[model samples]
Target: MEITSVLIYIIVLFLSTIFSYPFLKKLKWNSKSIPYKLPPGSMGWPYIGETLQLYSQDPNIFFATKQRRYGEIFKSHILGCPCVMLASPEATKFVLATHSELFKPTYPKSKEKMIGPSAIFFHQGNYHSLLRKLVQNCLSPGSLQKLVPDIEAIAISALQSWAGGDVINTFHEMKKFSFDVGILSVFGRLDKKHRENLKENYCIVDKGYNSFPTNIPGTTYHRALLARKRLSQIVNDIIYEREEKKILEKDLLGHFLNFKDEKGQVLSKDQISDNIIGVLFAAQDTTASVLTWTLKYLHDDQKLLEAVKAEQKAIYEENEGGKRPLTWAQTRNMPFTHRVILESLRMASIISFTFREAVVDVEYNGYLIPKGWKVLPLFRNIHHNPELFTDPQDFDPSRFEVAPKPNTFMPFGNGVHACPGNELAKMELLILIHHLVTKFRWEVVGSQSGIQYGPFPIPQNGLPARFWNESNNT
Candidate 1:
């Protein structure tokens, strides 16, 4: 009996060794790879960790709860990796500017795959700088001045379409408007069918950027991949056509075709296609989110709405009976309109936080952000902090009359990685609001609700509203 028991124990031990070796090996590798002091906080559950709460919960609540217990900088596992969340302005500046080289841009695997390797966010150092310069040339002040007329035309047409409607989804309309702006301003003019097709593919791709990474047939990620393939094919066809026709146009695509890098090497067909996708990703939905929030905020405040209307009315009155589309000077000169956009962005906090991963294990304020761990510069936390903005939850555009304290109002981000499209986005919003308030007015259909914070800010129920042309006064 004793001999039989000994054999059973040996068999059990041998089976456990075979089953556990791989996991143990990985565990050992992780420990050795990040053998440095970690910041203070919990890692939560074993595998999934704090990702669900950090991403799925109300951002203010999540950060507040964590901050209460763990203080300003805390360590946790989120978005499938270990992360150190930096909630203070100093920390934000450190990662975004001061020691930015130690932390490179990183996104969820799903986002990286969807945006592609050629996207600016995927590059670092010199390559990123060069790509940014190329993109900046396309969206430069000179280019924007030329593009304003087209933008105003699109905004006017979209508002006209919204006329005579009882209830419309403000978010959906803004999305369509922004998408059309991308099609025209980035790719130049296209036939309606081609434009619609591109919009459809982009919408599909946008839906899955923050989705699970699984590629099963029925998954959002799978659909996103398919949509991306279709989008690539469309872009490639345009590139070929432009090349064959020797089209020397002035839009973004034209700039790409003519762009010669420091080595005198222009972007290849695939590179151009990927970067265009990046432009659309950066420009469209994020602008839509801010626009929707602007509508919601304006509709809720009649006094503020009238003030905004007056500003636009003056601009229109200057245009000799509003006959000409808005000029770049007109758009740039709307101080109140600009302030309102800034306030809406601050209130909505469209981009909750941005992620950067440590390329080398580094120490900040005595806390260690280990190599490969993500560092979250908490934008929303800073935007909503009462210390930063008085009555932070109040919808007040006037607060932006004075410039926000440095590092405290970074809706478009700050430092080296600041969004190249920031000026263009602001111009788009200013133009859209100018048209909306001057030509049309909208009222909320039902009770206005709070915003939902995912990767973007979504107004509850898409902010359904009844629209009226100012002439009709209905």
Candidate 2:
């Protein structure tokens, strides 16, 4: 009772006034020593922090509203931490593209709550660099090309199997599809029981994404904590087995298990397991949601539907591999499909806001972001700005089809720690959609608005649509 009282009180106070606002000014903090300034936005009502205000219904409206009031750079308390919201193209480029070193991923939770401490995502400095190098080698362009067929195969299976009665929750199927694909991509083939365990454990870990910092019964965090242990054990066993056999395979786990930095120091099983799960979490949910929204938008927009299907038909016809699947070389030619997916990413901006925290006191745009204070780019602000895009809300792919108009788009984020599997994820989704659209005609069959983002929200209202073989549909 006492602890809860203190936490709520602190959160309240933190929201009402910047906890260190007065202090920041008193220190005569001049980070003018820095190169770029932060873009501006507003802080939130007292206790709730800027968290709610920034994401308040249709996040774009709030960002636009704030930018109007605050201009190009502003400060706010978000998620109980003081943060500087940067939105201008110049500011965003500094934070994301140029001065990436000054800021890095500040996901709300720690490794204990998210992955584990040794995971690649949680490592800083040399460890993160080393891990990234090793992992990159695993998913190198050539390596990724090899996995395309497998990823597409999994996607197709889910779509066909789940669409039982001309009605189905595509989001649900997409989630399952990504989960299975991620598992296969990372750990390779698995028995049904093992697959179920992986999914259930991942669910627990995912629940932790927004869970409070508590282990008490009935709390999502508690369940996630339990799941973490189970996952660690399963991964540890696999790592050891792989190590013992000295076998090599195409999966992410195999790559991690066998990796060594140039110094030749090998990664430990714990590190491998931690990084594996961390990467899987990063890959699966977001990509799945991307696929979900892509299907929704393409089907609803007639011109877009024809454009997408036409592209798919060409890919299928030209594919030396046929529907047997595509190599990255072949998939790369479908520019229209890529444009649609990129536009979907811009519109959905699934990762509405990516976060970072100051490890040292920093000054930008005449404001001080003190050590440990959180920061959010509000990527969607840049993604949806009318100045940056045409009819920002409209489903237009041509915006990205030709040369990108500068900082107008950054769906997978930018700079270091940006999604690495972008090419692989893109190929899998496009090919899946390509096969589905070319193979069957379909339509959304439910309340469009309700099918929105939850966490990694996708078309969840069950995108039921009448499907028929091409012969019947034509």
Query: Against the hidden reference, what TM-scores do the models get?
Result: 0.90, 0.86
Candidate 2 lDDT, tens digit per residue, 195-303? 7887888887886765446568877778888888898888776666666878687678776766677788887877877788887887777887888788789777888
Rate residue 35 of model 1 by lDDT. Answer: 45
What are the lDDT figures for the candidates, one per model?
0.81, 0.71
TM-score of 1: 0.90
Tell me the number of clashing residue pairs for each predicted model.
0, 9
Candidate 2: which pairs clash? Answer: 15-46, 16-46, 39-73, 40-72, 40-73, 40-74, 169-462, 453-457, 454-457
Task: State the weakest 10-residue window (summed lDDT) of model 1.
Answer: 20-29
Q: Write the per-residue lDDT of candidate 1 for residues 1-474, one digit (tens) a residue.
A: 134543543344345434434543343224455545667888776555665565444667887788778877998865446679988899999999988899898865668778777888777788788888877888899988988888888998899888886789888898899888877778877767777878888888988886656699988889999999899888888878888988888888888788887689878877878888988888888899999999888888889899999999998889865887788888889998888899999988888789898887687887777676778998988898899999998988789888889999999887789898899899989988888888886788877986654358788777888888888854
Error of 2 at 78 (Å): 2.2
Model 1 lDDT, full chain set: 0.81
Q: Highest lDDT: which candidate?
A: 1
The alpha-carbon deviation from the true structure for residue 371 of candidate 2, after best TM-score superposition, in angstroms, is 3.1
